[model samples]
Target: MTDPTARPADPIRPTDAEARTLARDLIAHARFAALAVLDPDSGAPMVTRIALVPGPDGVPLTLISTLSAHTSALAADPRCSLLIGEPGEKGDPLTHPRLTLQARAEPADKTALKAHYLSLYPKATLYYDFGDFGLYRFAPLAAHLNGGFGKAYRLTPADLAQ
Candidate 1:
């Protein structure tokens, strides 16, 4: 038998104005994101949920405890990915729009943004200043947007410019 490989039809559509808008909307409104990073010791993929908010300059930012596994992973390897979007309550979850961002996590100054960050997530004030916690900014390198079935587009950093 011939070698069989899975090659499904390319469902990704051309990047368009609507796709760009949807991607920006998703990125800007995301309150939380699924962060993916490589386990430093094991060299395996790991994912964890993180509270995300827009930084002073509108880049995706978050405060994370240095104790968390994901934080350690980021420290060892800044490469990471973020998935932003939540399925709607009334429809098939698979049909919901979502955006996956490939980014590099960089350390951000906590003191400069402490008050602004807390303004959006007052509850974080409890541990925001903990010595183990640090602020990180997700600098997007590229992104894939799934606007629903048959609605996919690959976007660039500019397309997601806030």
Candidate 2:
């Protein structure tokens, strides 16, 4: 048994380079993200699962249907956040690293991102050309990376760049 009275060890901060690499990996490998946007009507936070793809520059991008509330909310207000990284089957969920990226979402040029997006999500090809669906690219404004329990770091857009 461990000493109950002993204070837990302070978390060690990763170097800027390490943090940047981790952030890049998370964005690049993310199959999906939990996207949060402000509701246009109530001004309240709303979140939904969204499929993801990384831009050539390693920025996270997604396809959203114009019919969805989150898409409408994004159109009204571009500011949003994406929570990336999912825990594995075993071990404490809190011990898994995750990154919260605060960004501005804007309509992307379909011609520019289509191939890239489809390459990541081959299944999307069926509906990708549909009128209602459009690609949106996120420009990271700031980021908070929680590198497992007691490990965290604040990152700027520059840090996330490839």
Candidate 3:
């Protein structure tokens, strides 16, 4: 018999084909995500909304400003997390599907990504070439997907590979 006070280590379900499909779809179509990083100075968690795009092989990419707090934090510590997917027009927001990805931020070559990024976000061209702006890639480490109420799965980086 188990101790009454004991709790499960993780309530997440084992990954399945359905879960994989949902996770891939979310990552593949995500245009923007909530970026979470540790504040370099205060060590507090900071989250900011950012526009991101999927690159070759579904890797997440973002053009960020060096002056931004999030960028500074990422420079100090590459580990970060991202939340993708949005709630539908109807129903409680909590009842919708969402994905949280764990990743490491790494600097990406601006020249290689500029043209493609511009094609997707034309207006960004105004600032894409700014001296302080740079491109970065989020290397997936792991991901947690909440498909809906009672639906949760833990995914390895390989599960997200395109």
Q: Which has the greatest TM-score?
A: 3
Error of 3 at 116 (Å): 1.8
lDDT of 2 by residue, 1-162 (tens): 999999976564754887788888999999899999999999999999999989888989898899999999998999999999999899999999899999999888887788888999998988999999988999999999988887798899999988
What candidate 3 gets wrong by more than 4 Å, as runs, is: 1-10
Which regions of candidate 2 deviate over 4 angstroms? 1-15
What lDDT tens digits, residue by residue, belong to model 1 across residues 55-162? 867679989998899999999999999999999999899899999999999999999999988888788989998999999999989999999987889999988786
How much lDDT does each candidate structure score?
Answer: 0.91, 0.91, 0.91
Candidate 3 per-residue C-alpha lDDT over 56-81 given as tens digits, one digit per residue, 9 for 90 to 100: 76878999999999999999999999
Rank by TM-score, descending?
A: 3, 1, 2
What is the Å distance of residue 102 in model 2 from its true position? 0.2
Compared with the true structure, model 3 gives a TM-score of 0.92
Model 2 weakest lDDT span, ten residues long = 9-18
Clashing pairs in 2: none
TM-score against truth, every candidate: 0.91, 0.90, 0.92
